[model samples]
Target chain A: DVKVTQSSRYLVKRTGEKVFLECVQDMDHENMFWYRQDPGLGLRLIYFSYDVKMKEKGDIPEGYSVSREKKERFSLILESASTNQTSMYLCASRRAVETQYFGPGTRLLVL
Target chain B: DQQVKQNSPSLSVQEGRISILNCDYTNSMFDYFLWYKKYPAEGPTFLISISSIKDKNEDGRFTVFLNKSAKHLSLHIVPSQPGDSAVYFCAASALMGAQKLVFGQGTRLTINP
Candidate 1:
């Protein structure tokens, strides 16, 4: 079975602090994605990478950035944490044009 | 505007009954549709999918129906169990090579015994 693991399941950070959320997939998939899910608004894509060192901004990429240094790991970085950024963050991996497998989400809270 | 829409916010059904969740899309270019189920504190899981070429696809207790003319699709779970209660999201992808799925707002389903 394919497994996608996030570094933290729950996190709390202070305002103005830098935050890092890590995701790793054992499937060796070529595509990785980061999305933030909010109530009523649903899931909005933040960033996606098709290959190592390659990234693309999604619809809502402001205040967020991503790093894909290796084939199996992808990281989402919050330059400066704020209260507005608190939400559930999800990481997913997929092969070209194939179904995406998601990891257990990380719930982030900024105080 | 919203490309994919799930108008219903929530639905409640009795256990052992059928639960039908609906989804509609305005983008005519969408060729592939999929449904995902998510539990609280967990990521969404792929449930079933259908291509434009077929009207229906079934897997065990879950079945997906697609209507190209109406640009609508539905997920049917027969004999719905308590475990089947979750939030259902509908998504569509236009191109085959790069599956950039546009998802709906999602519908929360509750099963009552």
Candidate 2:
């Protein structure tokens, strides 16, 4: 089974604090993505990496960044957390043009 | 502008009845479409997908129909069960877009007993 695992299922952070969410995939997929789900907004991509050490900004990437140091893992960073950044973060990995597999998701609450 | 849109914010259907959810896209470059089901506090799961070349694709009780001319698609669930209650999102991707998927606003589906 293709499995994607996130570092935390839920997180709470104070305003202006730095936050990092990690995701790991066991399927050796070459593409990984980070998305935030908001009410009435569905899932909007924050960032995506097609290869190690390579990253591209998505539709809603202003407040987020991503890193892919290794093939199996991707990380999303919020330089300074704000209440507007509170959301359900999802990580997805796909191989070539195949369907994406998602992690359980991390619900972050920025206070 | 929203490239992908799910007109209905929510839908309610009784058990054993067919549930239909609709999606529309404005980007003509999108040639691939997909449907995902998400439960509260959980990541969206892949439900079904249909390529622009084909009009229909079915998996078990879930069937997806695509209309390329209209830039629209629909998902039909037969004999909807309580477990099928979830938010349904439609996504589209173009060959040039690589792996990035543009998603719809999503429709909340409720299955009543």
Candidate 3:
């Protein structure tokens, strides 16, 4: 089974603080994605990486950025955490055109 | 703009009954559709998927029906169990999108014992 692990299950940060959410996959999948889930809004993609050092902005990438320095790890960076950024963050990893496996998710609370 | 839509925000069903969840898409280019289940504070998990070529796909108690002409699909769960209660998100991807999925707002399902 593919296993995707996130850095934290819950995170808290103050306003204007930088936040980092890490994700690692054991299956060596080349594709990884980050999404923030909100009530009545579903899951919106923040960013995705197709390969090492390759990244692309998704539909809702406004206040988020991502880094993929290695094939097994993907990182999401919050430049300046705001209250609006408080939400459940999920990480998913997949092979080309395959089903995406997701981590447990991290609930971020920016105060 | 909101390519995928799950109109029903919530549904309640009695155990041992059938639960039908519907999804619609505005983009005709979508060739792959998927269903995912998510629990509170957890990431969405892949439930089932269907390709445009097939009208129906079934696994265990879950069946996915696709209607290409209407650009719609539905997920049917038979003998619904309390554990089946979760938020279900419908997602779609165009063949050339490289698996970038557009997801609906999701439907929260509840099963009564």
Instruction: Choose the strongest candidate by lDDT.
Output: 2
User: Model-by-model lDDT, in order?
Assistant: 0.93, 0.94, 0.93
Candidate 2 residue pairs in backbone clash: none
- Per-model interface RMSD values are 1.0, 0.9, 1.0
DockQ score for candidate 3: 0.83
Residue B51, model 1, lDDT:
86
Q: Which docking band does candidate 3 fall into? A: high
Clashing pairs in 1: none
TM-score, prediction 2:
0.98
Better of 1 and 3 by TM-score: 3
lDDT string, candidate 3, A1-111, tens digits: 779999999998999999999999999888899998999999899999999999999988988889999999999999999999999999998887778889999999999
Candidate 2 DockQ category? high
* DockQ, all candidates in order: 0.79, 0.83, 0.83
Reference-based TM-score of each model: 0.97, 0.98, 0.98
The residue ranges of model 1 lying beyond 4 angstroms of the native Cα positions read none
lDDT of 3: 0.93
